[model samples]
Target: MQKSLRVGQILYTNVLPVYYYFDQPKFEDRIQFIRQVPAQLNQAMAAGEIDLGPISSFSYAEHASQYVALADLSVSAKGRVGSLFLFSKKPIEQLNGAKIAFTNTSATTVNLLKIILLKFYDYEISYVTQEPVLEEMLLGADAALLIGDDAIQAKRNSHNLHVYDLGELWHQFTGYSMTFAIWALRKAAIADHHDLIAEVHASFLDSKRKTKENPAPLIDYVHTHFGGEKEEWVRYFQGLQHDFGDVQRIGLEYYYRCAAELGLLAAPTTVDLWQAGGRQTKTTLTR
Candidate 1:
């Protein structure tokens, strides 16, 4: 029997469409899907606990040498992603030097928030990682960064809290879409299953196609499994994007550039993109 593929999946609603098919009994023999938050999945991929899955964009930069981008899929947004929000009692300008608690469940959004504050908003603030409880995070701090399902829930119950969509903020700061997460495969794992790459890639693409073709099933699944009004969930899904095309690639590269400038990495690393046709491309970069 062939070895089962170990796949990591982010439990965020934004990614459920891609993960929908994996839950079916047909895929059980071929794969083992591990659901986790973005940060935890990143750590798992880095530690080789899982073979491949969507990972935080910032974490990919930090671990670029360890994995390869599985082109054609990502969790991105043009603007106002709804799940990545910065809630504050005061305006962003007034929050300079303020204590802000960010969810430890994410790394990309935290870094992006810092970039927004320093580069665009032009101020330095103190940030600490904390549990993703909006109320608790804002108890002693001026603001809190909540993301994924927790952030969505916070928005639903937002009473007097100033909410800023990080996706819109990133777009306004830089005229480009934000690629929040990318499906990355462990290099060694992929190499071991080189002959099966095309089959695996096609399966995922088919799943995404099925998801887009008829969103009713997905929305129903979300409502049943995740709990949200159908109308609200529809709008939320509409705002999210998963195409890893040129536009998203440019945006991701720009993100890496900003990360590099912030000293997050020594320099922008090459994106090893696995093309849809099962070909590999080494994307070179400078600055």
Candidate 2:
């Protein structure tokens, strides 16, 4: 019997379209799946708890020495992702020096929010990390940052708060897609089990393809598990870009550059996407 590879997954509605159906017995046996939020997964990957999963892009940079990105797989958006937002009592410009509570479950969105505020708007704000409850996060703070399912739910219930989609803000400022998460594997794991890594990568790609072909599985999933209107679930998946193609690569590189300049990252990191057969490949493209 082949050794099973442990995988981490983000337990959110958005990821359902990419990974939901794989829960069937066929794929489950080979994959020892551990579900977690992005932040926890990031920490787990760095600590060698999970071999590979979709991790926050910012955390990837912080742990660049330990991981290599899985090519052609990412959670990104051109604009208005509808799942990562800053809800504020006042406009962004008016909130200088105001306290903003961010979701402790994310790293990419927190850095993205800071990059948008400091680089584009020239605004400064203090931040506190908290659990992603819109009401609880908004208490004692002028703004609250929410991501994934919490953000979508908050958008539905919010009437008076100013909601700024971080994806849209990044695109408006930089004209590139905002890559929130990337599939990353530990360097040593990939080195030790190239074939297993390839199998895992193909499994994710196949899952994503099947989900896109028939969205009913995902819609039904959110309806049964999350309790939402089917159409709303459909729209949420429609807003996501799961492939890290050339355009998305440029967007990701631009994001890294901006994050490095803003001191969110130690330095601008290279996009060394993983390849089958234990090869580490870096693609160069002109933006």
Candidate 3:
């Protein structure tokens, strides 16, 4: 019997479309789904607990030497990622030197927020990581950064609080789409299970394509599980970009450049994409 590939699934509504088809029985024998937040999934991928799945862009960049990204898979947003937000008591510009709280469930957005505030806005702010409770976070800090479902809920109940969508801010600053997460396979797992990995990657691409063709099932799944109006979920899914195309690649590379400049990364890293027939390609970016 072939070993079941352990794949990580982020526990967020944004990833519903990419993973919608995998819940069927057909993938059960071949794939073992391990669901968790991006931060936990990143740790699992690094610890070799999971073979391949969507991981934070920051995690992939930090350990790019250990994994190969799927050439066609990512969780990105072109201009407005409806789920990622910064809820504040005051305006973003006035938050300089103010204490802020960050959700511990994210790795990529934490750094992205730092880049936005420190690099782009030149705000000298301090932050602490806390659970994804916007009320509690804001109780002690002037602002709270939330991503995924927590952010969506917080934004809905903001009640006069200032909300800034990070994706829109990023696009305004860099003129590029922001890729928050990418599907990555550990190099060691690839060495042994290249064929199986390829099958899983194909399934992911198929799932995404089908979701785009008919998003009703995806939205229905979210509505049933997460509890929101269909129209709102419709707009949310429409804003997300799942393909790792040229535009997203350039944006991701630019993000790496910014991260390196901010010392968030030790050095700039190449995005190594896993190709068919067990081949590999590199996308290198320089200053």
Candidate 4:
């Protein structure tokens, strides 16, 4: 008998649409789910604790040599990602030499913030990583960057302070959608468990399709578990882009280029997208 594949799942509500149906009976015996925040999941993926799952795009880029991305799955946003925010005591323009506190729960957004500040905005800023507590983060720094549920709640209760959506900022800076996370499969796992990986990828695609056809169940789940208004959850789901198609690929490649130029990555790497038939295609950087 083939062993169950270890799959990583992000604990944030933004990923619900893709994973909403993963608890179904078909997946129960074939898959084992490991839930964690993006940062932890990144570590797990790197440490070989999980075979495949969605990881920070930056994490995928950094280890592009060891993994291949699923061509049809991603966590992205075109203009405004409702849950990724940078709350500031002052306008973003005036924070040239300011201190910014970042949530320790993220890897992609942390580096993306650096790219935005140092590369795009030409600001030389210092940063510290702290727990995802906005008020506490703000006490010690001029601004705080928060992602996932923490950012959502912070923005909801926010007043007077300026809240900048990182997705929006990225879209404005570059005319491409921003892909925050990608589904990555370890190369060793793919070599050993090709059939299982294909089945899991199909399950992910099916779940996303089902969610897009009827999002009411997902919204209700978020409302019951996460305790937010259904309308807000509705808008949040609507704003997110889940497909890793041409647009998302372009955006991710551009992000890799920018990150490499900023010294966040050792060098630009090809986006090796996994194909179901045990073949992978390398997407060379356009620049």
The best candidate in terms of lDDT: 4
lDDT of 3 by residue, 67-150 (tens): 999888999998999999999999997999999999999999999999999999999998899999999998999999999999
**What C-alpha lDDT do the candidate models reach, one value each?**
0.85, 0.85, 0.90, 0.90
Cα lDDT over the full model 2: 0.85
Q: Looking at candidate 4, what is the lDDT of residue 85?
A: 97
Which residue pairs clash within candidate 1? none
Error of 3 at 37 (Å): 0.5
For 153-270, candidate 4 gives per-residue lDDT tens digits of 8898989999999999999999889899999999988767888888788878888999999999999888998887999999999999999888888888898888889888998766
What range of 10 consecutive residues in model 3 has the weakest lDDT sum? 21-30
> How does candidate 3 score on lDDT?
0.90
Each candidate structure's count of clashing pairs: 0, 0, 0, 0
Poorly placed runs, candidate 3 (over 4 Å) = none
* Tens digit per residue, CA lDDT, model 1, 1-287: 76878888898888877767643465556778789999999999999998888999889989988888887889999887979999999887688789999999999899899888988887878878899999889988999999999998888888998899999999997878888999998888876676556566667777888898989999998888777699989989899998887778888788888878989778886678987565788875432
Question: How far out, in Å, is residue 71 in model 1?
Answer: 1.3
